[model samples]
Target chain A: DAMVIQNPRYQVTQFGKPVTLSCSQTLNHNVMYWYQQKSSQAPKLLFHYYDKDFNNEADTPDNFQSRRPNTSFCFLDIRSPGLGDAAMYLCATSRTARDEKLFFGSGTQLSVL
Target chain B: QQQVKQSPQSLIVQKGGISIINCAYENTAFDYFPWYQQFPGKGPALLIAIRPDVSEKKEGRFTISFNKSAKQFSLHIMDSQPGDSATYFCAPLSGSARQLTFGSGTQLTVLP
Candidate 1:
């Protein structure tokens, strides 16, 4: 089945340490997105890649960065993990950067100690 | 300001009952609305969606009621079951950017 896959279902990082979460998709979607969801809250948009162009949300912190090496792979890098950064990170893909259904991975839970 | 607002942060319903979750959006540019369901420790999956041009769309027991004039939409689960217990989020899709603005989410529990 074509779907989104995220590596390291659970991750633990020390404070100020750098951590990376990865996502891959077999859907061959042109648009990929990263979302941060805290406990009992909505998933907030961090950034997304439309084809190869990186689009960052205005409120996204500088500590968070994203990279799309190719259409099938995208990476989320946290330069300095803070305690508040601990949450579930979700990766989603869509056929286009317009109104369309999204395919999401199981998600990676980050715990900053 | 939050672009999307959802109500009734939590709800409990009996099996065979009806479950309703409501959401409102302030963005007029939003022409697409989708509802996602997420279970514990899993990512959200698309359940049902509705376009502003239509007032309602249904798939099996899941239904989406959209009101373009009111800028609101709702998800209704018919004959709710224990397996239907999960968190539901209403997200509005807007622009060529396709960035989805999600509501806070509603946690629904269906007791058997």
Candidate 2:
């Protein structure tokens, strides 16, 4: 099935260490998004790629960065992991920018220790 | 401003009962509303959606009741079952890129 896939379902990283999460999609959607979700809170948009153009949320931290190497692959890089950065990282894709529904991946559960 | 607000952090319902989750949004420009269901360790899936031009929409056992004038929308799951237990989120989309503003989320448990 055409779907979004994330690598390393569970990731454990040492404090201040760098970690990278990957997402790939078979659906070939035009828009890809990254979101950070802590326990019981809404998923916060970190950044997204429209084709190859990157859009970052105003409040996203500097430690968080993303790259869309190509149409089907996107990566989230944490410059320095912190305890507060432990959360589920979700990747999603949509066909277009207007009123389009997103399809999400299972998510990477990051644990910063 | 936190554009969206959701109620009932958690809810418990017996099998075959009705499950309702509510959300309100502050953005009047929001034209699209969607409800997503998330299972443990899984990503959220689109359950149903509605537009401000419509008051309600139903798909199978899921329904979205939208009150455009009030800036509120709700999801109603009919004949709820254990399989329906999941986290429910209501979101409104607007502006360029149509970025979604989501509610905090409500965890629903349907006892079998």
Candidate 3:
């Protein structure tokens, strides 16, 4: 089945260390997104890539960055992991920018020690 | 600031009962409203959505009642079951942005 896939379901990083989370999609979606979800909270949009164009949320921290090498893969890089940065990072994809239905991966749980 | 406000942070319902989750949004420009269901250790998946032009949308036992004038929407789960237990979020979409503005979320627990 065509779906979103995230690598390293669980990740542990030390403070100030850099870590990367990856996502790949077989759905052939044109839009890819990254969201940060804390315990008992809503998933917050970090950034997204519409085809090759990158769109970042205004309140997203500078430490978070994303790269979309191509349509099938997108990566999230944390420049310097902080204790507060520990959360579940989710990756999602949609057929188009206007499409309402989003297919999400299982998600990567990041633990910043 | 929470663009959408969801009531009853958590709820418990018995099997065969009805579970209702309510949300209110301040953005009048939001034309698309979607509800997502998330299980433990998993990402949220879109369950159902309703456009402002419609008053309600239903799929199986799940229903979304939308009120454009009041800027309030709700999700109703009929004959709630244990498998239906999960966290539900209200995310509204505005034309200005391609992404969604999510509400705080509500945890639903259906006991058998």
lDDT of each: 0.93, 0.92, 0.93
The residue-by-residue lDDT of candidate 1 on A3-100, one tens digit each, is: 99999999999999999999999988999999999999989999998899999999999999999999999999999999999999999999987637
Candidate 2, B1-112: lDDT as tens digits: 8889998889999999999999998988888899999999998898899988889999999999999888899999999999999999997888654887889999999998
**In candidate 1, residue B52 scores what lDDT?**
83
DockQ for every model, please: 0.84, 0.84, 0.87
**What tens-digit string does per-residue lDDT give for candidate 3 at B1-112?**
5679998899999999999999999988898999999999988999999988889999999999998888899999999999999999999899877578888999999999
Candidate 3: segments with Cα more than 4 A from true spot: none
Ranking by DockQ: 3, 1, 2
Candidate 2 interface RMSD after superposing interface residues: 1.1
Candidate 1 is graded, for docking, as: high
- Candidate 3's displacement at residue B104, Å, is 0.6
Better of 1 and 3 by lDDT: 3
Off by over 4 Å in 2: none
| Candidate 2 Cα deviation (angstroms), residue B27 | 0.8
